[model samples]
Target: MSFLELSLTLHARQQERVELALEDLGALSITLRDADADTPDERAIFEPGVGELPLWNEIVLDALFDSAADRSGLVHALHELVPGLAPDRFTFREVEDRDWTRAWIDRFKPMSFGARLWIYPSTVAPGADDADKIIVHLDPGLAFGTGTHPTTALCLEWLDATDLEGRTVIDYGCGSGVLAVAALKLGALRVIGVDNDPQAIEASRVNAERNGVADRIDLHLPEDFPRRRENILVANILAGPLADLAPLFADCVEPGGLLALSGILQGQEGELLVRYAQWFDDLAVAVREDWVRISGRRRG
Candidate 1:
């Protein structure tokens, strides 16, 4: 069946009301994207924490409806929902239905991190030359961390270079359990994956099982995670949260244990270093694109 897609560029403040109005008017689905995406003025907004709904200052809201539905009714409802919304800001188009899952999978191929680590969707098999590769089987889902982002790639590469043999690792803010699963497959005795989002926890579980390391990984929501010192701790969260959780992260690593942090923009490393210096030593930094990975050892 064909669908009618309506795209509206609106101020962030008006998003909720418009979305509700569209839903009331029988929108099948509503999705949002940053209107300034990929531009030099792009904003780096953190993923919302649980129970939080944050939007960009400028947003492109897309809503899908049955093609046979009343288009004029939708426009009228939107006008009433947002009194000052501009007519020129709305665009309507016909969308043909296709297998969206297959489309997404087609864009994701095997991606390599460093020399030894490889990430591939479950739909694809590794080549014969990948016999010695450390494979991480992941399928794109609601959670992030597919190793496509520079932040994730930096962490994955760092994991590849680290000697995880018999070490207990913790992946703070574990998304899709990619890093934690990689650690387990790389010989970590056990790994703990923690995230604030329940969806992320579930995604991590599924990815871990797919990688055949579910038995070696323990997934948890932040509040339910046990307080224990790990041999190595990695957090690929943004710089803001990394700084805020400095003490917590420090406490989770054993004295002299290693810590690796990513999701930091190039210019933001200094602030993080200063924050982490209170509990860690020998801090080093690695850069990929505008993102960086910082590693250090917990001091006694």
Candidate 2:
């Protein structure tokens, strides 16, 4: 189904505010992109928020026009959602997705994580498999993660290299339950994927079953974080969220257990390390492309 594509020109600080405002108005998925493609470091991201409302429907267009007439409403809402943003600094426009959103996965391919592990959706898994490799099958859904992104890849690779045989692992922001599944594939005795989003929990469960590890990897809500400490904790969420979740990540891992994190920009490494330092000792950074994956062990 075609979706209404909305675009907004927002200042650095105003980005989240605008996105939240749009979300309140019915956006399902959003991407932040630079206004100018040639300028990669221009302090902007082309954010796309998708809604189920079809763009071809004139009724949806009419509502957009009506909403645009009172842009101040969104502007005011932004100021409330995010502080210190001058509403006038933001501009909004609406476009038709015209199938552009669905194409985001066009480039997706079977990804091999670690040295010998491969993950493929049942429909996408290559017909021929190397006898030596461990292959996992998964299907795409609306969940937040896929191993295709560097952030997810780093975490997957780490889980691959770690000796998880019979270890208990927790995936803090289990997107498609990919990392947890990976851990199970590596021989973790038990794994669980946790997320606040119900969709993520559902997707993770289904993906776990698809990979033949549903029984091994349990799904839980973020609030229902298991009381037992895990042998390993892996969180591949954004830098800010990871920092906020540092204490929880530390608490979840058993003493001497490792915590692996991704979804951080290169420059944010020092700050992240400092935040995690209070809880985790001997933090180390792993670089993949321009992204940094922070991994460390919890202090007793």
Among these predicted structures, which one has the highest TM-score?
1
Instruction: Give stretches of model 2 more than 4 Å off.
Output: 1-106
Q: Any runs in candidate 1 off by more than 4 Å, and if so which?
A: 1-98
lDDT score, residue 61, model 2?
12
* Model 1 accuracy (lDDT, Cα): 0.79
TM-scores of all predicted structures = 0.70, 0.69
Residue 46, model 1, lDDT: 34
lDDT of 2 by residue, 2-102 (tens): 34343444444444334433433323445665443445465343323432222211111111222222456445534543456544445566655344423
lDDT string, candidate 1, 211-264, tens digits: 788898888888899988989999987677899999999889999999999877
State residue 140's C-alpha deviation in candidate 1, in Å: 1.3
